[model samples]
Structures are given as structure tokens and as C-alpha cells.
Target chain A: MSRFTKIALIGLILFPFAFLLMLSLGKQWPYPAIFPEQWSLSNWQLVLGGSEGLGNSVLVSVLLSLSVATLSTSLSFWVSRHIAYHPKREAWLSLAYFPYVFAPVILAACLQFFFIVAGLYGTFGGVLVAQLFITFPYGVIFFSSFWNERLRSMEELVKTLGGSTAQAYAKVLVPVAKGALMTCFFQLFLISWFEYGLTNLIGVGKVPTLTLRVFQYVSEANIFLAALASCLLILPPVALLWLNRAVVFREG
Target chain B: MLTIKNINKQYKGEAVLQGLSFTLRAHEMLSILGRSGSGKTTLLKVLAGLETADSGQLLLDGQDLSPVPANQRGVVYLYQEALLFPHLNVFENIAFGLRLRRRPETEIKEKVNGLLQRLELPGQARKMPEQLSGGQRQRVAFGRALIIEPRVLLLDEPFGALDAETRRSMQQLLKRVAKDFGLTAIFVTHDLKEAMLMGDRLGMMQNGQLKIYGNRAEFIADESTGALDEARFWTDLQGLKLTK
Candidate 1:
């Protein structure tokens, strides 16, 4: 690619984020004005000060994504291994796709009744569970290809080498799967991080995750606040992408 | 001695091993020759406690091993692939079983280094599995298994993937190590020559049954074992060359 082409592509990719950052700092732009009449740190200040609750939203989103990612990645890894080796492997694996068959919003709506009865509706825990309905199965499907005959043999080898089942996982399988697990965690984290529909329905406006806040500000037509929320929303996933790239490059 | 008695195994209602019985004396390597699906691997897995026999008893030194779990059975099963822990280096791989036993770091280092030297993998301790050649990887695997000092070593076509030259060298190395370590092992292979070359006693598996030969001559004379056929082929080749 030419230098001009490269620069153009880079700008193309970065323009929206730069625009968001600029808009987050700008205010009082009249109609037909390309630039705002005034620019200040007030919007950022409001978010950081917790007055706008954007900071709280950020915290909630981070915590929820982290929990969902960690839980689902680990649970799915264990579950997928069993399913891979099970006699009815195809049957069990097909069920992991069931959640994805319907949209997350529809799935959440379906599960809302159960959540209400279980006293989880309109709560952080409820949203987390709802998000898991999507991310967990994704994790299972993601890790399904990882468990093969060689890995099964490796596990058996560990056993025959005087290592217990736990030791087999800890000493060999888990370490061997470190890359896959990290990749799965990153993907699942993103799934939970940007998740909107399920969080909206299940949270019932109680769990104000950053995604919800972004949409809230957008609907309210508060462009500056929305931009700020959007910036906050992409931070974790961007950081995660950077980290994942570094890991993958180093491994390569 | 390791004694296998009336071991029967079935997969999907089809018998894989039918009343398979064998007696292996201490320090003896019994090589079983069979084609694929001949129940050779099933026999080894059953002995290693990786697979349970439908109705059989595995007696290691006259003690019942049927109830023991695989880890506690003191039998190491090696596959055709080296199956070395890719995350670990040569030294760590060799020391894996010892580390599992929670041996002292000094002891582990000492034994692993010594085994590395014995495996002719000296100065290659820091190399990862991916860095090693196929034969080298197998040697590391053998070192790993031997470091644990298992009661029986069950090898299922351990050198099946190696080139002819490497396979021969590996066979020699295994024979030397087996004698020096006084290792009692069951080496399963499909290669006719490998079965004869590696075994102190030979057995042939056909239709889920194992027939132990009384001696090499008897094994060669047994038509069903294909020993005679292999010998005749080579003889015919030699004759053709002489005639030309």
C-alpha cells in the first residue's frame, strides 16, 4: 500500500473515536455548525465526579464483564471437555447453540419470568445471569474444538504418569490451554461488555452498565454525555484487544 | 511378574479383547504384534488401568490391580506420539512424574539430569518439545516415564511414527535401557520385525485373542503370525537379485 493509502486507512479507522473524544469535550454547538461554540472538560468532569453516574456505570460494566467472562470461560472449558468426550457429544454440543438460536433480547424476555420468581429481576445478578445465557454457550462452542483425541491421550498420559485428575488439568491441560482460554475470555468479555439488549430487559433500568448509560444518553439526545459514555464503553475492550495482540504476537 | 487373566473388552457390543491372558516376567519385554483393530492397544490400556476390562484381573507381582486407579497403578503408558508436555522443557518433562510425587527439587534435578544424559539428551535440557526432533522427543518421553520407575511400562507403537533409521536406533536404545533399568514392559507394535526385535517373548493378536510364542523359532514357524510370509518375501527378493 502507498503511504497516502496507509494514512487514509488509519484515519478512516480512527476518525470516529477521535470524533467521539472531541464531541465529548465540546458543547453548545448551534445548527449547521461543524464545530461546537465552546469546548471544556465539564462533561468528562461530570462523568468522573460520579454526578452523572457514568463512573458508577463504568465500574458496574467492568465488574459484570469480568465476572461473566471468568465464570463462563472456566465453566465452559470444563463442560466442553466432558461434552467432547461424552458418547452423545454431538447432542450436547448442539444444545450449546440453542441460546444463540434466538436473539439475546428474546432469550432474556423468556427468562425474565424465572428471574422474577427467583428474586433476581432488576438486579446486577440478574443481568449477569442473563448475559451468561449468551456468553457461556459461546464459550462452550469456542472451546469445543480444543478437546481432541490428542488432548484426551495427554490427560490419560498424565494419569499414568502418577498425576491425579486435578493434577492433570493443573499441570498439563490448563497450561496447554492457556492461549485458548485467554482468547475465549477476551471474546466472552467483549460479548458481556457490549451486551445491551439482555442487560436492558433483565436489569430493568436498575443495572446501569456503561452500555445502558450510552444508550440512555443517546436516547435523551445528550450528545456530549453519550460520547463520553461511548468512550468509557470501548475502553476495556480496546485495552483487552491491545493485550491480546501483544500476547498473540509474542507467542507467534 | 505381571499376570493378565481372562481380560475381555467390548465396544458397542463387539468384542475387542476376548479372554486375553498373558504372563510377563520381571525385566522381560513382551512385544505383541497385531494389525489395527487386533486388540493390541486394548490389552495395553487395560494393563495400564486406562481402560477397564469387562471381566479380567490384572495382577502386578501377584497383587490384584483391578481396583487401583490409573494414577495409582504404577504403570506408564506411552503412545506412538511422544506426547511430551509442550509447555515444559526437556528437563521439566523428564521430571514431571517425580514432581507429581512432590520429590525434592534437588532430587528431581539430579535424577532428571542423569536421565537426560542416559537418554543421550545431555545439553538439551532447556529445549522445548517443539524444538526437538521426533526421535529426541521420544527419548525425552521415555526418560519421563523411566524417571517415575513404574512397575510396568506399556508402549503402544511407541516408535511407529519415526523414520526407519530412527526406529532402529530407538529400538536399540529401548532394549539397552530396558535391560539396564530392568524394566518389565509390554511393547505393542504392528511391525513384524519390531515385534521380534524388541520382545524377550513374542505374542501375536488375531481376532481379539493373543497367542504367545514359545520361542523365536516357533514364532517364525507360525503361519498365522505372518512371520513365515515376511521371511519368504525377503528370501524371494534376495533370490531375484542373485538371479539378475
Candidate 2:
């Protein structure tokens, strides 16, 4: 590989371990160096292995991520397929994104407010409703091209071969779109997992996500603990990236 | 048998066909020849029930096929691209129609096997469309369209993707298959050589109508005239207004 690539490879390897070691060591820095003078799992325990029953936060994040990704991707799949064939498809797509692009946070607030007015307030269903629009746009963007160009041809071909539109989509379109679906799911999941402003703003303190816990810890001057929480927050995404390195290699 | 009479179409206030008409007998391989955007493919779409005509009537087997849906019309369309489903294997692609009707497993296997053999794709039954070469993919498309036993086949530049040799071979294959299966096919092309070689009778489309049509000798006779004559033929075929 080239020199730049080599340096990037080296940086990728060393950066994570260096930061994790420093954070675990708390304030015990070595003299005139970035290395910690002392290293221990005490802070790791103080933040990550805490007896605060963070299990709830973990469960909430994982569940919300999974549900949001699934809901958004599913919605976008059918909508994108139908809209892809529209005569003025690009124009209509631009219109669909209007709600998404213009003040998404504001739109989420309006949706949240509407949900409260409709008596869905403080409910799990209400939180999911708020996240649908938040996560929906990404899935639409991701799957729209696939449906229009790649999957559209495939579906039509299958249709000619005697498959119904629905069968064609379920059988051929979905399989060819597997890569896109995976990417959409991960991206949407990540969005829902890391969202602080919307989740905190809309849920109105009724529900707690991992991001809420992070900020809660951050304001108390527990910088190391907060960083540890951030690290913990980063793990699932990093693990997901590692698990699907195929997608990363392609994206890279 | 398929018959189109006085078929008229327009796009954005522009007329494509003005009283265009034709008759395609069973097992007759008829080719529609035209320059680009001469409404040849549009006519094929109208014949296949993919597009509606502004005015005129289409009769298939003496019944009005205008109201029929594309799939139910027994009108199979082959795009310039083979358009094979990327997710499906060769067998699945070829067996698409049978699968839709819920054909028996033994029959599907037997028919698809026959297709694989006929198309010289015997060992590629499990391979996806991406794995096949351009020629291989087109052959598979041909087999898939034929296996359905469509009453009328509409091809839109079906050999446009193939090399010269492959196109020649496919043209021959189509001729034999169209005769053997009694398929009334409306093949479209803009190439002079392709149109002559593929069709039993060729129709030259210009503007919105078939203007120059006949057997090989007739088209040749028209071609022997001056370039201006040929240009006039195109103009009359399309009903274009000239600056003269």
C-alpha cells in the first residue's frame, strides 16, 4: 500500500487502545507524557461496571435501535418501490424530503406534540412514533436508488417471468437489496441509539436512552466516568461495524 | 394472430401515429424498423398493451386486446437489457412464469432443465445473472420469454447488447424458435442489417407510422433511390412537415 494508507493503518490500530488505557487510569498520568502513571480497573468499574443497573439503559438503546431500523426500512422499501416508478419520481422524492430536510428536530417536536395531544404521551409507542420520522429519511435515501435502478429492473424481469409484483419483491428485490437493507438498518439504528436532543426533548423524561444517561453523568463533573459511558456508548456501533466488516470494506 | 388498425399516439401534443395499421399472422416474425425516436418501440408498447393509444383498436385472435393487461395479454416484452433478476439463479429466472402459476415441482424442474440444455447453459442453473456474460444472460432471457409460451412476443432492441456474431446467432435462434413455437413476434430494431435479417416482413417507421413496408426486395428497391428519396421516405413515414 501507499505511505498514507500505511500510516492510516497504523493509526487505526494504536488509537483505540491508547485512549481506553488513559481513561481507565483516571488522573494517574506519567511525568511529562500522555501515558498514565498508574493503571487500574477502578474507573472502568466506576463507569462501566457500575452497580447502577445500567441494564435498563442498555436494553432501551438496543430495543429502540432495532425497532426504529426495522420500522423505517420496512416503510421505505414499499414506498420507494412504488414511488420509484412515478413519472415525476425525482420531483416527488424531493417533496418527501422536504419534511425531513427542513428542521427535522422541529418536525420531530411537532410530531411529539401531536402524539401527546392524541394521548400517546409518555408511552413506548409514542417514543417509537417520534423516532419513525427521525429514522425514516435515511432508509428512504438508502433504498430509493436500489429500488429505482437496480431492484426495479430485477422486479420487472421477474414479473415478465410470471412472478406477481409482490412475489418479485419478496423473492428477488429483497435478496439483491440485502446489502442496502443492512446498511439502512445499521445507520437508522445508530441514529436512534445516539440521539440525545430529540429523545430527551420528546420523551419528556418519561423514557431513558443511553444518551440521556451519558449527559446525566457528564454534567456532574465525572469526566472520566462520562468518557467511559461514551466509550460504552461507542461499543455497540463499533462491534456492529466489526461484525459486518464486509460492508465497511466496501464503503471504505 | 394480432391486428392493429388506425393506431394513433402522441407525446406532449406531438402526434406519433396517424392511422397506422398492421396485421401479424401466427408464427410470423415481423420486424419494426425505424431511426431513433420514430415511435417504433412506442408502437410495440401499444401492441403489448404496455401503452394506451389515443385512438385506434387492437385485436388479438379477433378479440380486442386493448383492455387486456400486459401480463394477461400473453404479450411478453424483452428489453434491450436482458433484465435478468440478479437475486435469482439461472433456473429460477427461466422458471419464473411457471413458478407464478404454481406449476408442479417435477414439471418446473423438467422444463427448466430443457431450457438450460436448449440455451447451452446446462451447468449454470445455480448461477446468478451477474455471473453470466452478456450473451449468456440474453440467451437465458430468450429462454424465459419462450418458456412462457406467450401468444405475442415484443422485443425492444433485444440484440442491441450483443456483439455482431452473437447477434447473428441470436437472430437465427429467434427465427427458428418463432417458427417452431408458432410465436407471432413483433421485433424492433433501428439497424438496417438487423431488421432485414430478423424479420420475414419488415415495416419502416418514421414519425408515428409505418411508411415503407414490404418484403426484402421492396425495401431494397426503395433504398436504391437517392439519399434525398430515402430522406423523403423517412419524412413521409413520420408525417413530418419540411422547410421546403
Candidate 3:
């Protein structure tokens, strides 16, 4: 909305175009122009390579995001509902987000150490658990206000209606809170999908997310496929961003 | 058939309810009137099992109620907002409780459609909550609560957020619904006029206590004491203005 923010938005939008331009036209350093003269589809095929690890990266990213979102969002429901509705919820709120409050890399390290001991090192399950640490904060933040403002007060109304806590949740709370829940799930998914700190460290150099794969290609100077992979990685969030932006979260 | 005996609650180091006691007989509509922070909402919460008392006994139909969890208690609460499910259309929202009991799809459809006809909200079964207007959404929330067929009904300023015209209309509709359902209704609000219009009996609360209570006519005379003090203050203000 501000001039600086507007310019920054323009710059980000154009960065991909510029990258595309370079992939097709850059024969030397710093081609000074607003556009590129060359365009080709060969860059697409070379990086695609039967899309082997590229496909794997996409699958792994999906798996990571889905698992982390479900786990974190589920945990957050309990934590938030109890805190908002329970008699002594205030006493628990102080320590509600300790894992969230800590730095991501440090948390990842501790998780990595724990995973190694637990025989989850270098596995998808290990990365999933680590990513849970990464995204659970976002889910908890997303679901807390939703549970409080809408469902917390309505718990009584639904209950006296022959509805149990489970029924109220399944019937009324879940229905009323669907948008928030979906957004929380998608938010955690996005966070986990893009999470590099935990994935890069705990993945033990074998597990390949699109993010890690992109880094691999970039480090190999394979910018063309990296760009394509980046494009693939950016698509999910870009589509869901508009849909889920209204769900309240730490981003509040 | 709900009874409260000497229940007390404290919030953040201040007492909100001190030795509160009452009963809700079957098929009666009770309205609670109060000033803000007078514990009207607290009373409703305690009765509906949303809150716990520091010390008291609660009974329903001569059976103690403390052991029952909120959901299993057969009490339905309606909030001021429509509080309908965003994901579900009107029909699904109404059929939710039935679905929870795992009712057969045909029976679920029959019940929901039957209620839709009875409520005169024909062919609105598929609409989303957001798609409906304020009154319509409120009706759908009522439909959702009503379809559960609970023993007790609690409405916490259920129409408080509506415009004045809509609020009056909702009150009439609610009264009709309570009669049709044979509900033991407990409506909570701070608006004395609304309470008078809706309640068979009225209870007035102040400073976390149920200070005065009686039927509609008696409640006005009881509150007239406080109202007279208010009138005197207004008369004094007028005198000051005239002198100025």
C-alpha cells in the first residue's frame, strides 16, 4: 500500500520475468535492458530430466506439508480450546508456545539430535516431525482466536441442545470454524513445504524437498531448472494465499 | 427442569456469583435482565454447564447435574451472532446433529425438510450462512439448535446484534419456537425492555448476584426503585441546566 511496499511488490513480480529473460538470453554479465530478446523451451527440458528428483521433490513437499498441517492443527485445537474454555486456561497460556517462541534453527537442531537418538534421522518421518515444530506455531496462532471468539462462548448453547463436546465440535464448532480450520491446515502446509532450516538439517542430505532440490540445482549452477522448480514450488502458496489470508494467525 | 443451589464463582480475584440459586421448570421461558458485568452471562454459562461454581449444587429433573459434561446435558445455547457453519449450507447445518447421531440419510432429509416447511423457510436448504441476510442467518442458527430437540434452550442475547425492527421480529419468532418445542428457555440480556417482552418471568442481576426476580409485571415495579433514583438524577440535571 505504501510507496516502498508498492515498489517492492513490483520488484518481486518482475524478478521471475527477469530470471526467465536471463535463462533464455544471458550470454554475459549484466545485460542492461527492460526485456530480453531471446526465448527458448530447451531450458525447460534440460532441468526437467524426466523430472526424476523434481517429481520426488514435489511429492515429498506435499507429504511434508500435509502431515505437518494435520498434526499441528490437531494439537492446536486441544491447546486452544482448553485455554479458552477451561477454568484455569490462563495459567497454561504463559507456556503455550515455548517451541514457537524459540528460534527455528535452534529448535531444528534439538529436534535433529532427538531424531538421531530415536532412529528417525534421514527419513521422511523425521523431517515431518521437525516440520511440525516449524509450523505448529502458525496453526496454534490461527486456531486460538477462532476457538475463543466463536466456539468458546457457543459451547454452552450447543451442549444444552443434546450435543456432546465431540458432537458440538463435529456439528457446530467445526462447521462455524471451517474456514479457520482450512486456513490453518493450508498455512501449516505452506510453512512446512517451504521450511528449509529443519528439512536441510535433519534430512541428513538424502531427503529432497523441492526447496532442497532447488538449492541443489542452484548450487550446481543449473539455474534454468531451478527456476522451473521454483515456479512449481511457488504455485501452491500463490493459489492458496488469497483463499486462506483471512484466517487469523500469528500473522495477525 | 434445571435447578441451581447456592452456586458461587470468582473471576480474576473478584467474586462474580455469590451463593446464586434458582430453578428452570419445563416449558417455561425465563429472561434474565442485568446491567453490564452483572453476571447474567455467567449465570447462563453455569446453568448450561459451560462454567463451574466454586460451591453449589445443580440438578435437572431431581437428578444432580454436576457429573454431566456440557455436550451430553441436552442443553442448546444460541449466541447473539448467527454462528452458523461457513462450510455448510443451511440444510447441512440443520441436519448436523442428526448426522452426528448417525441417523440414516433419508430420515435426516425428511426431518430437515419437514422443519424447513414448518419454519416457512422453504427452499433455503442449500444456501450458505453468508449468503443469507441477518434475519435469515439467525433463523438458520435457530434451526440448527432446534433440530437437536434438546430439553433446555439457552439464548445469550441471541438477537442483540440485530437492528431494532429485526430484533423485535426475532423475539416474536423465538417465542413461537419455544412454545412449539416445549422448551425450558433461559434468555439472557441487559436490555430490560427486551427481557420484559420475551420472558414469562424476569430475574435482575447486579454485581454478580441475582438481586431481584419475579414475573414480568413484578420485575418492572422492583426495578422502578432503581429507575426512580435515575429519574431523580435526570430531574436534578434539568434543574442545573435551567439555572445555568
Candidate 4:
């Protein structure tokens, strides 16, 4: 890349984080001043030191994101095989995009009746199922490209080598596909981490994720706390994005 | 001994293999020559159970193998492209079959190392497939398939991707490997010289029909096999007027 392009990209990334840091530190600096009148780490202390139950919110967010990512990635890895190999795979893949086209909040509202009937309303399971409808489509699209003639030849190689079905998957398919699986896991994790609308409607305000807590503070007009929570939510995804770039681009 | 009786295959309502029948003697390597789209690959796929024939009987040692699945067919088909497992190193790719069979580690190591030496790739045990040349990668694939002790090895233009020098050396290596292992093999190629060099018997296919020759004299003399046409072309060139 050109030097100017690199500088512009770095500036674009750093400018937002710099503003968030300023907002999280300054107590009040209304108007005309280009800089904060005064700054302190008091808000950071409150957010990080468990005074606002931010620690619990972070824990809940991490656990839910981990579960959702793990379940969706694993489920789709196997399920995509059937869809990819089907004769009508193109038609089926187009249908798979239906749930994701609608807004997540609208979809959650539409599915709330089923959740209530299944006795999952106001529970973590309800929220997880709702999130699944969003993340599983990503997995399907990501994995659909995996089934080509090369993979078929590899599978036939296994069978002719006296391998069974279980051995073909365990020995060949999983090992070859490991890199893609990791990429999918990290992406799904980030998706669930930043989600708010579905969780709020389904968790019924009981299961407070970090995103929900950030919005709550924002509504109460607590700029410092909201900025701090937003920073927490944004940092991991940024780190993961950088890691993914390194992994994919370096290999190619 | 292996026998294929009246194998028929169709694709998109077109006949790719029609009433194809041939018997391969024990330890015999049959080289098949055909024009492109002459169904050489389809025959191999059916023999390897990668594709099912519409109707056929495949017999090994007088027992029908028509009902067998691809994995249980004991037939290995090597492609024109050496499709080695990219995630595996040279030794691991060769040892894949043994590992799946749960062979003892010592046995697996001894067998793989021995084959590596025979294929002249001993120093490449730890190297990935991407790190090897085209010829070396094809050798590794050969070792990988040979280690399984398959009933029939079907080679589909195995040296088609190599440079001329590499192709010659690989052909020599394969000739030695087949002889040393007493392997029953079917070699397919569009190159007449390559087919003649590799096969104990020769066959030609055109428009999904095959004709095999048990004798080399008849195979070379047959006009439809193209060998006589090649000879006639050379003889006719000798009669051209000298302009210089």
C-alpha cells in the first residue's frame, strides 16, 4: 500500500478510540473548548471496579457469546455438508438467507410467541435461540464453498484407503477444514458479543449483556460509563479482526 | 485376477460406457489409449466404485464385487493431478492408510520410510505437499496409494502434468514399482507411446466402445489403433522432394 493510504487507515481507526477515551475521562466540558476542561480516571474505576455490576455483565456477555459461537459453528459445520452436496443446493442456500434478511428486533418480536409457548421466555435459552437465527446463516454461507470436487476426491481417497465414514471425517475433513472453522468461530463470537435487540426482547431485561448495559447507561445520560462500556465491547472485535487478517493474508 | 462383465454407464441420457467388458490377469498392467471424452475415466471411476455403473459385474478372485462400496472395493485410482493431503507432511500422507488401519507405529514407520527410499524421497519426510515439486508430489501420492495393497490400481494419466524429463523418470519409477510389488494395474493415457511403454496389454477406446489387444504385434499393426497411421506419416515424409 501507499504511505498516504496507510496513514489514512491508521487515522481512521485511532480517531474513534481517541474520542472514546476523552469522553470516558472528562467529567464535563460543555461547548467551545476543543479539549476537556478536566479529566479523571474515576469513571474507569467505577466501570472496572464492579461498582455498577459491570463485572457481572461482562461475565454474562462472554459466556453467552462463547456458547452461541460454539453451538452455531459446530452445528453448521455438519449441517452444511448435506446442503452443499444436495442437488438443489442453490435453491436451498437462497432459502437459508430468509431469517437474516429481516431485522433482528423484528424477527425476535415475531418469534416471541413460540418462545412463550416453549416456556423459554424470560430465560437465557430464549435469548440464545433468537441469536442462533442470526448467526447460523453466516455459518451456512461460509461453509457452502467448502464442498467441491477436490474435497470429494479426498473423501474417495480415504475410502479407497480402507477408511470408514467416521475416520474420513475425523482424519481428513476436520484437519483440512480447521483454519476455516477457527475463522467462523471468531466471527460468530463477535456477532453475539455486540448483539442487543434480540437479547433485550427475549431476555426480558433480566439477562443484561454488556451491549444492553451500555445502552442502559446511555439512556440515563451517563456518558463516561457508556463510553467505557462501548470501549470494552469494541476492543475484542478489533483485536480479532486484526488477528484474522494476519492469519488469512499471511498464508496467501 | 479381476473381471469386469458388461459394465454400462450413462450421464445426462448419453452413453459414456456401453457394454464394456474386459478381464485383467493377475499382476497384469493394462494400458488404455483413448481420445478425450472416450470414457476412459468413467471406466476407472466405476472400477474404483467412485461411480456406480448402471449394470455390471466386477469379480475379484471369482467373487462378485458389484455390491461393494467405494471404501471396501480395494481399488485405488490415481488422478492426473496428485491430490495429496495438504495439511499432512510427506510421511504422514504416506502413513495415512496404515494409521487408519491402526497398524503398529513401528510397522508404519518402517513401511513408510522404506517406500520413501524406494521413491527417492527419503529426505522429504517432514516437508509439506506445497514444498515439493510436481514429480515428488506425484511420487508421494503413488506411495500413499501403493501402501494400501489394493486389488487393482487405476492410473488416470498420472504423468500428464509433468515436464517431459520428469514424466520419463516417473514412468520408469512406476514401471519398477509395479514389477517389484507384483501389482495388477490399469494405466490410461491419450499418449500412445506412454500407453505402449506402461501396459502389458494394450486397449483402445472410441465413442464409449473398447477393444483390447493381447499381443503387441496386433496392437501395433491395427490401423484403427493409430500406431500404423503414425508409421505411415513418417514413411510418407521420407518421400518428399528436396528443395534445398
- The runs of at least 3 residues in candidate 2 whose Cα sits more than 4 Å from the true structure, single-residue gaps closed, are A1-53, A96-112, A147-153, A223-228, A247-252, B211-217, B222-244
Report the poorest 10 consecutive residues by lDDT, candidate 3 chain A.
A21-30
**Winner by TM-score between candidate 4 and candidate 2:** 4
Give candidate 3 misplaced runs (Cα > 4 Å).
A1-59, A77-112, A142-147, A172-187, A220-252, B104-127, B131-136, B211-244
lDDT of 3 by residue, A1-252 (tens): 899999999999888766754654332233575443555666555446654467677777877777788899888866677776667755665555777767777888777778999988898988887777657655655665665655555655556655667776776676566666777777777778788877888887678888888788789986656667787787777667765765544333
Error of 3 at B144 (Å): 3.2
TM-score of each: 0.98, 0.82, 0.74, 0.90
* Error in Å for residue B236 of model 2: 26
Put down candidate 1 lDDT per residue, A39-134, tens digits, no spaces: 999998998778998888889999999999999999999999999999999999999999988988889889989999999999999998888899
Better by lDDT, candidate 4 or 1: 1
Ordered by TM-score, highest first, the candidates read 1, 4, 2, 3
Residue B161 in candidate 4 has what lDDT? 94
- Give each model's whole-structure lDDT: 0.93, 0.77, 0.76, 0.90
DockQ metric, candidate 3 = 0.48
Candidate 1: share of reference interface contacts reproduced: 0.84
Q: Tell me model 1's lDDT, rounded to 2 decimals.
A: 0.93
Please list all clashing residue pairs in model 4, or write none if there are none.
Answer: none
Question: Chain A only: TM-score of every candidate?
Answer: 0.98, 0.81, 0.79, 0.90
Going through the candidates in order, their DockQ values are 0.91, 0.38, 0.48, 0.73
What is the per-residue lDDT of model 1 for residues B1-244, given as tens digits with 9 covering 90 to 100?
9988989999999999999888999999999999999998888888888888999888999899999999998999999999999999999999999999999999999999899889999899999999999999999999999999999999999999999999999999999999999999999999999999999999999989999998999999999889899989999999999999
- Say which candidate scores most in DockQ: 1
